[model samples]
Target: MRGVDVLSTAFKNAFRSRLRTSLTVLAIFIGAFTLSLTNGLGTGINQYIDDTVASVGVDDVMTVTKASEEEPTDGPAEYDPNQIAADGAPGATATALTDDDIDTIAGIDGVESVEPSKSVMVDYVRHDDGTRYQLSVAEFVPGMRIELVSGEQVDLDASDPELVLPESYVEPLDLGSAADAVGQTVVLAVTDATGEQVTTEATVVGVAEPGVLTMGGAVPNDVLAAELYDLQTTGAPEAETTRYAEASVSFDTSGGATQTEALQDRLADAGFTGSTLEDQLGTITAVIDGIVLVLNGFAVIALVAAGIGIVNTLFMAVQERTREVGLMKAMGLSSGRVFSLFSIEAVVIGLVGSALGVLGAVGAGQLVNGVSGDLLADLPGLTLIAFDPVGVATVVLGVMAIAFLAGTLPALRAARQDPISSLRYE
Candidate 1:
């Protein structure tokens, strides 16, 4: 029989056995749907990570201090920085990062700029009700220009006392707006080098952009410093500063991979430890990818089960058509023609089932997203699920291959049937 004729006959027979054909198609549909959902989720996670990294400006590298050197002791040693500082003792022999370190980092190859910062814990007085809040004072060095929504960036050269606060703090205190908070004076109490509580008044200067505070627990670093320093008669003495933070070097480069590797090497050479946004994002992406892979494996098993069902159904069809096959052979139909006819039916079943599966998955994805939107509305950096066409196409092709293999044994058996013996058996 011609290929088209064979396909037509196979489809006709498939519809004639409606119940079995429907069950077989349903099996394929379940397998395809599962595979597509997992694949689409994986893609969505990757895209979300990429978006977060891009929004945060991954070209910059950050450096933070590691634990201090300590002599070997018998019992488990406490390593908390807060506890050590509370004990009125310096925990580490390693020197705090200084202007010299910043200069050295800036001199490195591919280094575009460097910013040094220092943070100290202090007490803040709420302007409206005079409630106390623990705050960290941060100093911003020159060349680190953060995007500001209101007012101006910290003036590294100006000795005038100024402070900035995060927008998050404004709403909790019933501070009407960030713009109103600007130019208002707030008092900050800080412990001096001699452990004396000194209060300083600083004028609010500006508000940082929302993106700056989205990832890490960031605040107005320079503003807090100005507040604490202005309150004290003798501002925080440099020698007594406990913790120092720095943005040692930032590059004007692109491509997260190359920049991360180069920055890691530079940090290691400078006796510091740090991580880039790309590294953190990569860790998250790897975990999501592993989960997707495990789920896909389960989906593959489901598809295998469906394939077996297809084989069984085709075998039953062959048995029921034994006399018919024998008659066709007697009428000069070739074995190759019989095989082609059976294969065509399997392909058609697979294609139709895959189409249904794709439609179902897409609809389900949309429904899930709609329900999740309300729950995720308040979550920062949350991403919605989406469908991927490339993944759908891959799943369809895989299903078709499995279906064709399932039909192969039955087709071969029917092709080898003997006309004269078969006619006599029944």
Candidate 2:
């Protein structure tokens, strides 16, 4: 038979044994649906992480700290009575970075520069006719911008003493809403280095929404940071004034991954450790990816079981069609055409099963999202099962390939049957 004729005959023949073929197709459908749903789950979660990562921190910048110098000893090392600390610097007990450490970091090759993290020691924060509350303030780091509820973000490069208030702080400060809080000034009281109380004021330029990677507190412009740092250290001797909690390290990544790793390696060897934002989220992503992989394993086992079903059904079809195969051969049909005909039947089953499974999965995904969306209202931008067209197409093609492989043995058996022996048997 011609190829088209063989395909046409195969299509018609597939449904001749409706019950058996339907059972096999149903088996394949279950496997495909499971596999596609699992894939979509992975895709949705990873995509959400990627979106969060954009606000997590700057990819080119890494947080750095001095490697701890004290090694564990059986007993406390010989005390150095002469080990003196700068008069106003951080206490020896604290892991305080100093100007010298910053200088050392800047000296490293491939290092751009370092910005020391300024700790804003606020005694109390109070808004117009509102109760005073203790609050923590953080400087606006480049690339780690928070999602805005209203107004605009703090311009880190600008010298204005602008602050982005957190949503949680809105009601406490008597700010009715994000829009109402904008352009309002709040008073911040702190104890300067001279042990005297100092009060500073900053304008509320914006309000921030909650985010996974944000500080969850007030974000201040560079001017506020500089202002607070000066007040906290003013009148203290320079030797005691310049201390840092940690520092932001910037490096050139134009050298690509290899050079970026090399730079980090060099920093490590120099007694300083640096970690990019990805490093911070590495463990989280690893755990998520591992769970997704385990779920996918179960889906694949189902697909494998479906393949066996395909094999059994094709074998049964080959037996039932033996007389028909003999008759076709007797009419001058080539063995290759007979093989093609059986293979096409398997392909047809795969196509029907995959189409049903994929369409069903899409509908089920919508139902799951609708049911769970309100239950997970806090987790915005999350779709538990989300499909990618390419991923869905890949699953379909993979199932069809498995079906084609399963039918190979049956096709070969049908092609090898002797015409005279097969015709006389029945």
Candidate 3:
């Protein structure tokens, strides 16, 4: 028989035992549906992480800090006056990066430049007669990208002190709306040295959406941060004001990963620790991927069970069609052709079941995505379940391959039957 003729005949025969074939197909459907959903979950989360990494960090910049040589003891050790408050936060001290350390880092190979990291603390923010709300402001870094709800990102080079308000702060601060807050003035009060209150006013340049990097804090440009830092340190010793907990080092990006590692090694040799954005966020991605892998294991187990069902279904079909096989052999059909016929039937069943499963998964994923979009409305640009065409295709083809393999034994038994003996038995 021609290939087309054989394929058509096999498809027709596949549903002869309707209930049995349906049960076997249902098993395969369960496995395919599960596999597709798990893959979609992984794709969606990883995509969101990729976008967040791009928006939050710069690839060519590394955050460098002086590594603490003092080992941890059972109790607090004697305080060293040389150590400064880390990030300028009260009660937190660390080995501060001084002017000498900055010069040493600049002299290191492959470093383009270094900027002292500043941590600005704002006591409270008040707009007009609105209530005073405690506000945490994050320092701005060059080349940083932030997702904005309205207006534009803070400009570090701008002469005036500019700040971006977080979405959560708008209503509480009585800023009206995100758009209305732009270009408005807000007062920030900070306590200077000698325990005196100091107030600084900054214009709102933009409003930012809630994000991983912002951590519910306001974002301040260089001018705003420098102004706040200066106010907070007024009347303090000049030597103490210059001390910093860390620095931002910009490096050559053309060298890629090898160059990045070399620069980090050089920093380590200088008694400093340098970490790129990937180093800081790698643990998050690793944990996410690991969870997806575990979930996939369960789907694979279901597929294996489905494979066994395919084997049993084909074996029964072979037994029930023993006479038909003998009659076909009695005609001009060859053993190879008989084998091909049975294999095609198995493939046809796999195609039907897998197609339905993939379609069903797509439907379910869309529904979940819609529901999650509302539930996670605060997290813009996130899809909870997203399907990739290539991944879905891989699942369908994999299930069909398993079905073909399971039919092999049955096809072989039919091929080996002796025509004269099989025809006389019934």
Candidate 4:
């Protein structure tokens, strides 16, 4: 028979048992829709995590102080006065990282760039309004994650004290407009390495967009440090100045697993032991992927139930058509034709159901995203609900394949019917 004639025959047969055909198609649609939703949600979540990590410059690694090997010293007897506080006991000491450490790490094979930064907690006040905030701040190391949104970045060697503020902090202080805040003076109260509250003034040189703060709240670090030095010291002049205890190192290329291992070895050789951001993210992604795999597996149970429905429906169709199969054979239709007709009908049901399933999944995804927008508005990362064409295609094809397989046995049974016996018995 021609393709058009076969299709027409298939449609006539389906229409003769409209309720059964409808139920079979509905089963396929539900299965395909559920599969699409699960796959799309998983893809969206992974994309969100990747974007969040990228925003933070996940390629960089930070080196901080390790636990001390030496035991605590007693009495001030052998202690260096510079290392001891006025109380004569060991004072609050900072990490020993210095330019020498930077030089050592920079020499590592994979290292592309390194920036040293230090942070201290302090009290800050607006010069004009005198409003105070307990601020933790760090200095700008040029060519780092923090980018200047207004004005210029602080000059590394400039004598004048300049500062940057987190964009979020700008509105609360009424720092005028972005332009107005530039060149304005703000006062910072901070403790030096020796631990004394010192206050000094600095120009608001720039502002950073939100999500860029690495260590603490979004106060400008350079301004805080310079201001602390300007404040008059109440104690002896010989007090040690606080230094940055760590450095952020960025590589030229994405090292993936191999690069991470090489970088860790280099860091260990330089006498620093700390976790890489990439390694931590890898661990997190692995855990999340495992959880998703398990959840997807459970969801597949629904699809299996729908598959079983398809099998049962086809089996019933075969039983109903036994005498029809005998008539077709006596009318000169071959066994192959009889089988082809039923198989074609099954495929038609699957195709139509899969198309509807795609529509349903797309609509559901959009609804979910609309409702979730408000909850995710303040979040720094990508949203988790999304429509992915590849994932939709995969689900549709998978359901259709399952449907075709479910109909196979019934098609074979209908084809193998003995024409004379089927007509005589029924």
Candidate 5:
């Protein structure tokens, strides 16, 4: 028989018992459905995380902090003046970053520059409507990620006090929308030496969207940072004023990921630890990936069960068609063609099952995502289950490959049947 004839015969033979074929296909469908859904879930979440991380962190710069050497005691030790202290946070056992540390960090190989972090204390910040809210500021260091809902990033070099507002603050600040908030003047209040509230005005430069990695805090320009530092420490002594919380170290990007990691390793060797945005969020990503992996493993288990179904189904088909196999071989059909015919039947079953399963998964995923939209409204641009064409195709091909492997033993048995004995059997 010709190749086309063999294929056509195999396809017809696949549905010789419609109910039997349907049951086997259903088994494959369950596995494919689970696999596609899990893959889509993983893709959607990881893609969102990648986008947010890119928006909020710089790859080439590392945030450096002093390493805490554990002075193990019988229990928690009381305030000892011998060790360094965190300046902004009271009673925190943090080693304050000094000028010498900056010099040494700057002297490290591959380091381009070092910017010391200064903690600003603003008593309160309010819009023109005089509604005051609690104040906190984040620094705009190299590689820091920020996405503006409207307006531009903070002008760090601007001589005047420029501030970026988080989206959550736009409404509370009595600013109607993010767009209208830009270019408006906001008043920041601080306590003076006499413990009186001193008000200062700053221009609103941008409105930023909150992200998983981006803290929902405002960013003040260098001018504002210095001003807030001065206002907060005006009454405090010089010893307290000289201390810094941490510093940012910028490294050359010419070398790539390995080089950047090496620089961080070198920093650790010097009694300091450096972390990029990826390093900071590594644990979070790892957890997400781990959950996805566990879910995928379950899907794979379903697939393995489906593979066994393929094996059993093909084995039974071969048994029922023994006489037909003998007759075809008697009619000059080669063993190779017989084997190809059975394998093609297996392929058709896989194709039908995988196609239906993918359609089902996509429909279910869409329904879930649609219902979840309102619940996840706070997290904009998030698609709960998103299917990638390449990933989908991979899933389909993967199932088909498994089916082919499962059909091998049965296909070989059918190919090796004896024509004289098989034709004489009842």
Candidate 6:
């Protein structure tokens, strides 16, 4: 048969045995569906992470801390007065980052600038005659951003103290809605270094929507954070007050991951640990990727099982068409043409099944994404399942390739038939 005739005959022949072909197609469909869905899951989650990275403005920022000098051992070492315990970790000690450390980080190659981070604690927050509620303030870095439901991010250069309230606090603080919370004034109570309570008033510049980076707390402008830090250290020694737990370092990453890694390595050699936002969130992405890989493994197994079905179905078709094959060979068709016919038929089956599976997966993914979008409204900008065109195409092509490979043995058997012997036997 010629090209068009071969293809037309192959397609017509593929479904001659309706029940058997349908079973084979169904098998391929299951594998294709599973593979597409898992790929979409990975794509969706990673896309969300990328969006968060862009939205939060932490793409080129790295958090740096003084490396601990204490060696690891089975037993705890003697306490050192100079080492300070991190907040929330009662007994864990960390080397403090001092002015010299900040200066050292600033002097490193590729470093744009450095800002020391300050830990500020607030006893309670009260608005007007509302009852006091405990609160925590997050340090505001220069390039960091907060997703706001109302108003704008805190104005770092503004002379007066300013802060952004978490959306959760609006109702309990009697601040009405997120919109109403903006421009309101609130009192923050804190204890000074002298062991005395100090209260400060700060304007609410914005109300932030909940986000992974925000850590479910109020965000403060540099001015407000400095004010709080100063108040907390009122009676403390100047040297002690300058020590910090960590610092934010801005770096040039135009050369990409390699350059970033080199900078981190340099920082490590300088007795500091530097981690980019991606580095901090790597564990989460790694876990997600691993889960996707595992799910894909199941899909691959299904595809392999489907390949066996293709093999069996084609083998039966070859047997049933033996007389037809003998007649075609007598009518001037070559063994290669017979092989091509069977292989093309297998491909046709694969195309039908994979196409159906891809379409079904896309439809199902959209439904799931819609339901999840509504259910996870708080986590804005997230799509639980998103399909990539390339990935979908890859799945379809992959299934078809498996089908072609599985039909090889059947095609070979049909090609090897002796025209005279096959015609004489039934």
TM-scores for all candidates: the values are 0.72, 0.77, 0.83, 0.67, 0.82, 0.88
Give the per-residue lDDT of model 3 (tens digit) for 386-405: 88889899989988998899
CA lDDT of every candidate: 0.67, 0.81, 0.86, 0.65, 0.83, 0.89
lDDT of 4 by residue, 1-426 (tens): 677888889767755778988887788777777766776677777777666567656455544332233456785544333221211136654335556666776787777776655444556655576567655565444434554558766655667766677656666677877777778887767655456766777778787655423343444445345455445333535333333455667665465767677777767766665455555556667777777677667556766777777678777887888888888888888888878787766767777777787788778888877777766644444455565777777777777677678767788888898898767755
RMSD (CA, Å), candidate 2 to true, equals: 6.1
What tens digits encode model 6's per-residue C-alpha lDDT throughout 1-426? 579999999999998999999999999999999999999999999889888987887778898988888787889687776687774457776788999889999999989999999998899999996899999887666778999989998896899999999899999999998898889999998899889999999999999998777877899888889889999999999888989988999988798999999999999999999988888778678889999999999998999998999889999998999989999999989999999999988888888888998898999999999999899887888988898899999999999999999888899999999988878757
In terms of lDDT, model 2 sits at: 0.81
Specify the highest-TM-score model's number: 6
List pairs with backbone clashes in candidate 2: 88-240, 89-240
Off by over 4 Å in 2: 54-57, 65-100, 118-140, 157-161, 185-202, 215-217, 222-246, 253-259, 278-286, 371-373, 424-426
Q: How many residue pairs clash in each candidate?
A: 3, 2, 0, 1, 4, 0
lDDT of 1 by residue, 10-69 (tens): 889766788998999999899888887787778866876676567545446554443244
lDDT of 5 by residue, 299-346 (tens): 889988988888889899999988989998999989999898898888
Model 4 lDDT, full chain set: 0.65
Best by lDDT: 6
The number of residue pairs in model 5 that clash at the backbone is 4
Cα deviation in Å at residue 15, candidate 1?
3.1
lDDT of 5 at 242: 64
RMSD of each: 5.9, 6.1, 4.2, 8.0, 4.2, 3.2
Task: Identify the runs in model 4 with alpha carbons over 4 angstroms from their true place.
Answer: 1-16, 49-104, 113-167, 176-247, 254-291, 329-344, 380-383, 424-426
Ranking by lDDT: 6, 3, 5, 2, 1, 4
Candidate 2 TM-score versus the reference: 0.77
